[model samples]
Structure formats: structure tokens, C-alpha cells
Target: MSLILEEISVKREHSFRSKIDVLPHIEVPWHYHPEYELIFIEKSHGTLVVGDCIDHFNDGDMIFIGPNTPHIMKNDDLFYSKESEERVIAWVVHFKEDSFGKEFFLLPEMKRIKEMLINSFKGIRIDGSTKYKIIQLLQNLHNSDYSQRIIILLQILQLIAQSEDLEYLASDSFVESFKQSSNQKLYKIYEYVSENFQQKIDLDEAAKVANMSKTAFCRFFKSKTQKTFSEFLNEMRINYAQKLLAEGKLTVAQIAYECGFNSPSYFNKQFKANTGKTPLQKKEHSY
Candidate 1:
């Protein structure tokens, strides 16, 4: 109901904490913390909010979130019903940036892991065979001893770092949306675009949301988020299209118009570019 700091359980002898949870629903309020999180959802289907990125998640879903990122998994209403048989099943690991040694990531051998850790700032979703493997490692951790626990954890990180199936959830925006922090300016702009993505948004109108000149807003946004305004807007539209695709309620052409694309073919091309799959392919996979 409110944004709060979550205290992930950590034993005095260990620098990292791991827990496997099965819940009627994930009832935590929106929150953030000072630890990197590796999460695997074994069984659940719900809306997941990460930074400013909103999307659906299900069984076999996995993501890595960096410190200070706000997130929550809000299961669908059915999961809360007393007669429902569904459950929220997940495993999560939390460790601080310097959990190993402050200088450990500085070593040459740890370069890739170090970069992957940095990328976690945007929240990375793992898919394809990599998700399957990471889920396996997380599930088997309970059977291993402390030493193996560390080894397997590192292996998981290494595998994710090397994977091409990783998708960043917030690479384009700068909103700590859940916390309602001072980053509200960017959040406002992001919200505006998300809600109006189905219409032809004027650049001047977008800049007005940021209270800056069009050129100035472009410079400021790119400087802060490393993505141009156009790029971020397209990302938002494509994400919305993905949601529509999963709903199975609209034809591809209808969805294309609903998402503000001028034509279905152009929308399909962008969808493939953003998600690595065409609309028809995603629809087929969804069922």
C-alpha cells in the first residue's frame, strides 16, 4: 500500500540472503533496497512493475534488479480468491554490491560480471534457455552447502552475463516511479508518453511536459537516460503492443493503429525489432 524498505533476511555468517516463497499473492508494498536481487518465478502470472517498465510475468520468469530499484509483483485478482488453486511461487537472492569484496569486481577476470552488475541498474529479464538454466540453479541452492551456494550463485551470474537473451526493462527512462522521488519530472514525461502513445505526439508537446524547449528537452533527456526521446517513445509503444498481443483481443492491424503506428507492417517491423518476435509469432507462443 506504501513504499517501504524491505529487510531481506541475511544470516550473520553470510553476505547474501536467499529465500524461496510460495504465497497466495505477493502482498508487499512497492519498495526499494540496497541490494542486487536475482529472482525466479517458478509459478505465477501477474503484472510486474520494475522501475518505469510495466509488463506481465509468469512461470519460468527471471530478472536481476540492482540496488535502489523499486519493484513489486501484483498478481491478478484470481490469485487472491479463496477458491482459486493458483499460487505465487518464487526464489530470490539478495546481496549488496560489495558482498564479495569491494575490489573483487575490479579484477580482470570479473570484467564481464562487473559490467553485467552495472546493467542490472536497469533490471534485466532473462529468457530462452538461459531462463530455464537459471531457474534450475536457484531451485537447487537449498541442497548445496554454503561453499557450493556461493559457487552456484556466481555461476548463475556468469551465465546471465554471457547470455544474449537478456532484455533490460528500463533502459530508456529515468523514473523511480514507485518511490515518487524527485525524479518526478521524468516520470511525468514517461507517464504522458505511455498514456498517449496511441496518438501522434508532437515533440513540442512532449517538451512541454518537461517544461523545456524541444531541443533542450531532447538534450536533457538523452543526457540523463542515455536514450533519445524518439527511442524511448518507440520503446513504450512497442511494449504496449506486446501487452495487446498477449491479450488476444485485437487483430494485428487494429493493434497497430491502437499503438499509434500508421500501418500494420511498420508496427510489425518495430515489434520484431524491440521484442525479437513478430506479432503473429508472439500470439502463437502465448497460447
Candidate 2:
């Protein structure tokens, strides 16, 4: 899949866009835009790929992404199954840096917010009491009057600026490469992996996606993602396995093969290596 440049337009009556999205499932592809985004998932289970970092996300997860950062949140396999029904409910706000006037963030009182925004180039995952407070504000944001909504937005930023429970999700090297390079080729490589991670993927085949030889492609992928191709592939498989375990619809052995692991024992080892827990343990805890 090529990187899609999403176009977001603020309504003429508003300075930024803020709303709640309720859908059968999230249909957005891997994409980027010029606006910074704050999103809180009220109800969902998925794998979030931000830049080169891959991780599982659950209900109540919140993240802030800076302008033009590439990201996508792909729901669990069950969400897409024809026999199952699940809904995605989320709060999303998109605003440009100058939404409050270009000079607003440069003011003396805005120092911390300015730094936080800069750090968001790598993407930030909100946690602890900060996430709890933001969830409340996000709920209020969707129904409040225009003037009150703007004030609440600033308050949310102020809270994030003062909190210590934020985690940056991407590496500096990945962010630098992403900004400097044309990402269409990178997106092609990602699309190939996302579509075929459930089967045996050949290095030569992946290299062909980028139009490079195997050796050259290996080096290029590692430089951009900070992980070897095999490591990346394992992480992707393990991520899918996590969702399946959570659903508890299949045996661990079934999940192993479904996630492309030829041996259930090997799947157990890698599952623990990536998640710090075995498949059975994760399945037991999910309930």
C-alpha cells in the first residue's frame, strides 16, 4: 500500500476539527497529514504501528502524533470477520500548530507545551493519571460549546505538558529518515508485510518491493527501522498472536500456525520474548 496523504479540512465555523468517530471498524489506511492529532480510543482492540514501532493497543489508549508522522491502527482479526460484530468508538482532534495563532505556543507560559509538541514527532503514548484526566476532557470536548471546547483543548495540552507519564513511541533515527526520505517506497514495503505476514515471506520478495537486491534491502530496512527484517517480521507475527490470544477463540497451537509460526513451541518462545508472557498466560488474563 502506498502512503496516503490524508486531507483534513477544518470547518469554517471552527478553528480545528474535533469529533467522535463511531464505526463498524476503522477503515483508514497507513497515512499522514500536516495537522497534529490527539486521539483517545474509548472502545477498541488493535495493533498500532507508529513510524517503525509496533505495539498492541487496548481500550482507553490515547496517543498524540505530530504533523506528517505516518501511523495506522489496525483492529483485531475478529473485528473484520464476517460473522462477528464490533464497533470502533474514538475521540479525535486535529489541529495545525497555528490553530491558536502562530505566536501562541511561543509565549513564556507555553514552554512546556512547545517542548511536548516537538517530542510528539516520535509519537507519544499517554498513560497514568494523565490519560484518565484526558479521557474525561475528551468526553467533554465533543459536546461542549465552541468557546468552551477551545479552552478545554488548551487545558488538555497543559495537563500533558506537566505530566511525567508519557512514552515516546518511535526512534530518532526512524523519525529523521522518515522526514528526509520519500516514503512511498517505504510504504510499499510495509504494505507487502502487512498483507502477507501470515505466510512465509521471502527476503528476495520483500526486496523486490523496494526494487533493491536482498543484501542492499536488508541494510536499508534496518537503517530506516532500527530492526532487522526477520526481527520486524517476528514482531508483526507476535502482535497478531496477542490479539488472537485475547480473543481466546482458538487453541495456542492454532494461533501459532495462524500467525505463521510453523512450530507451536517456537511460537511460545517468541511470544514470551516479545510480550514477557506466554500465550496461555495472556489468554487467561484477557478474561
Candidate 3:
């Protein structure tokens, strides 16, 4: 779908937007905004598409997205089933670039926070001990006095700024603004990759879905993501494989085959190249 411009301003406060969404599914379409957003998904299982990155997300996942980045949390197929009882629950806060006053952020003491803000354009995943602190602070934000709430918000930002546990979503290339027609086609390609990355997918199939010749698809995909089609596919697979490794639910060999790798040896090689860890090591670290 086309990326729609979403307005997220809070009335009377000249501050930000903070609220919770609890529903059978995430109803928002692929959208972008001028405000930075901090979100905590308390319940849900889905594929998250942010800029040119496609990845899986689940409960307790928190993310920070910068202005004008298109993103959407697409629910798993089960959520769309009428008979399924799965529900989506999330807490979100949206703030403007100048909401803290431009001068305040320019002060010497705010340098680190300012740098973190600038880096958020690529989209950041808050992880490690900082995530736990953020979770507590975010809950506090809901009940604190207005002034205290702002203080806690700054603390959360500081935590994110100072912590080393962060993951960038769109590191290499990004679509700064959506092209109505092209974004729709890109979404189809994204959806296809998300649904079928565990299977053998040829560049020809992806090219047909994107309405481009195989060679043209290579150029188009690279222009959008700075990664070849195969690279993107392998990245997606590795991401999924990381999830499986963390779960400790399958052997390395089983995970390799399940994630579409031809063999465990190749899987181990790719896993180390992409994540700096072997399957067994990741599984151990997860515990």
C-alpha cells in the first residue's frame, strides 16, 4: 500500500502523542510521520517493515523511528483469521523534533542526546538492559505528573543514547519519501519476501512481482535497499534463523534446512558472516 502521511500531535499541550492500542489487529496502513516515535509492542506477533528493512517482531519489542520513515506492523496470518483469538497490544509515544525546544537540545549537556536523535532516522531497536529500564520508564510516563513525565521521557532518551544495545533498521539505503505507485509495488515485493523467504525463491519470481525484468529488478532493489535481491533474501533468512536460534527449539541442522539453507555448513558460514556468531553460539548466548 501507499505510504500515508500520519499526523500525531497532542492537543493543548504542544508536546507529543502517547497512547495505547489494543485490538484484534494493528489497523494502520503503511504510514510515515514528521514526528519521532517510540513504541513498545506488549503483545503481538508480526512482520515489521520499516523503510527498506523487513523483520519479525513480537511482544516486548521496542523501537524508535525517526521522522518521515515509512513503517507498518503487519500481523501474522493467524490474526487475520476470524476464528483466531490473537490480539494486538502496544504502547506508543510520538514527539516532534522541536518538541523539547531547539535551544534545549543545542546545549552542550544535550550533545549525546542530540546525536542519538539524529541517528534515529535509520530506525533503532532498543535492546539489552536499556530496554528493561525503558519499559519501566515508559510505564511510569503513563501515570506521572506532566512535568515528571517529561523528565522521565528525557531519562528514557538518555538511556537509549548512552546504551550500546541498539539495532539500526535501515542502515544502508532508505526511501526518504514514498512514491505512491512505486511504494505499492515495493510493498508487494516486501510481502512476498516476508511470506516466502523460507522457500526457494528465484530473482525471476521477485522481478515478476515487482513488474521489472530480472536485471532491472536487480537495479531497482539495489537502488531501494543497497542490497542485491539475493543478499536481501539471505539477510531475511538469517534474521529468521536468529530467532530460531534464540528460541533453542531446533538443532542447528534443523534450523538450517527450515530456514532454506541447503546445509548446516553453509548456514554456519552465513550466520557467522552476518551476526558474528555461529548457531550454537547464538543459542548459548540466548540463554
Candidate 4:
């Protein structure tokens, strides 16, 4: 696996068309492009890697990725079965900053849209009422003429700009690097960690996966991700814990053990530190 920066032209006369991809399996290799992308996952559930953030995503998840942000969506085992491989129907709208011209966004009418694009560098996940509206707009765009399509796109951007519940995914440090490198090592590392995050992952074992000495791997991983390997693993485990907790089918203790935390008390402590809420508190809030 290698990270490839997808080349995209920004000229309006060479407009990039919206694409509807029906992937048999969600296995996009980690890559990025110079186009702002709005993606809606119609089906399939899996782990989503956006920039340096790692989280699980389910059907109907909608994300707006800024230009040059590395990302991928990997299907989990539950999403594939003997009956059929899970279907991933995604609608992607890609456009460049100058698609409407450099001076377009500077107009008073486009202020909100400009702000939305600026905030998208952090990777926004549209949710609630706004999400439904955007989905509808995307559908209309798919069926409309070129002029109508452009109008719809602008409307969608305006909606996102006004949305207050948009969730940020990537950290500031994970901004675009636009560097190409063999992604095999990072992919293997993430796969191993995702599969066994509930158990202990020693530095020696993880280093071997990358074919580097423990010390060397530590430095390399940190330099690439801007996060210590342990920090990344812990965050991954915590992200799983959040999903499990959200389901409301398990007790906090059960979720702690299920997520691979050695002790329930430690799990509670970390959860609070990461989310600023206790397990029960979060559960109540969710309800």
C-alpha cells in the first residue's frame, strides 16, 4: 500500500462530475486529493480513517473532507457475510476552491460558504436536521441540469456553513502533508491494532509489523502521525468504547472489558479524561 496524492484539476471549464460509487467492499487505500469532497455512505459500516483521526462509522454517515486530507474507509467483518458482501453505496461531490473563481467566495453572499470551507480543514461530520437537508440536496444535484446542479451545490454549502452541530474529526496537527510513502507498514499496524485493541499490544510486536526496531518505529510513527503509538492505540480503544456505550446494551463494566481495558476503574478515569463525562453520565446524555 502506498499513499497517492490524487491529481485533480480546478478549472471550472473542466468541471469534475459527482460520482456514485458502489463498492463491493470498502477498501479504499489511504490517499488524498486536491478537491473538497462531500461523501455520504448509504450502506455498510466500518472504521473510517480521516487524516490522523480513527473512528467507526455506520450507514448514513456524512463527512465533508477538505482538499489533500488523507482518508480511507475499511469494512469490518460483520459487514461481510456469506449471503453477500456488504454494499457500500456512496455519493461523492468533488470540487476545487476556484471552481467558481477566486473572487466568487469573497462576495457578501458567499461569506458563509467561505467560512464553511475554512472550517472543513478540520474535517466536518454533518449531523441531525442539517444532514437530511444536505442529503436531499445531493440527490437533487444528481438529477438536475448543470446550472441547477451548481445552484444546489452552493445551497448545500450554505446549509453546512450555518450548521452548529457539525462534529470535527481531525486534529489540527494532522493537516495535509502531501507526501508519498509506502503505506503497507501503517496499514498493517492499523489493522493489527483495530483487531486486537482490546488486548495488550507491546512495542516489540508492533515494531516487528513495521519491520523496524522498537526505538526506530517509535520515532517514525510519531513523526508521521504526530502522536505516540500508545496514545494512538488508547484513542482507538476509547473510540470503540464510545460506540459500545452508545448502543445502550451493555453496562459500563461490560463495555470496559469488551473494549480491552484491564480495569473498569481505569476505564472510567480515561473515559472522563477524554470525553469530560462519566459512562453513566454520557449514557444519560445520549438518551
- Angstrom error of the Cα, residue 125, model 4: value is 1.5
TM-score of each: 0.70, 0.77, 0.77, 0.78
Candidate 3, residues 1-287: lDDT per residue as tens digits? 44578877686853777788899988788778889999999999888877656667989899999887777888889999999899888989998878878688899998999999988877899888999999899888887766887898899999999999999986444434233234666667776776577778988999999899998988877776667888777887887787778778899999999888888899899889988988898999999
lDDT of each: 0.81, 0.86, 0.82, 0.79
Model 3 residue 157 lDDT score: 90
Each model's number of backbone clashes?
Answer: 0, 0, 0, 0
Question: For model 3, how big is the CA root-mean-square deviation?
Answer: 4.0
**lDDT per residue (tens digit) for residues 117-204 in model 1:** 9878778999999988887888787667668888989999899989999989874445433334445556567556654677999889
How do all the candidates rank in terms of lDDT, highest first? 2, 3, 1, 4
lDDT of 4 by residue, 1-287 (tens): 45667765544543656867897776567777778999998887888777656677889999999876767778887656667656889998999888778788899998888888986876898999999999899889878876787888888998999898699887654453224334567756765675567787888999998899999999988877777998777777777777777778899999898878889999998889878999889988877
User: How many Å off is the CA of 237 in candidate 3?
Assistant: 1.7
Show pairs that collide, candidate 3. Answer: none
Better of 3 and 4 by lDDT: 3
Candidate 2's error at 223, in angstroms? 5.6
- Model 3 earns a TM-score of 0.77
Encode model 2's per-residue lDDT on 1-287: one tens digit a residue.
68789999888989999989998888899888989999999999887878756667889899999998888889998899877789999999999999989898999999999999988988999999999999888879888877998899999999998999998886676677676676577777866776677788999999999999999999988887778988878887886787678777899999999888889999999999988999899999999
Q: State which candidate, 2 or 4, has the greater lDDT.
A: 2
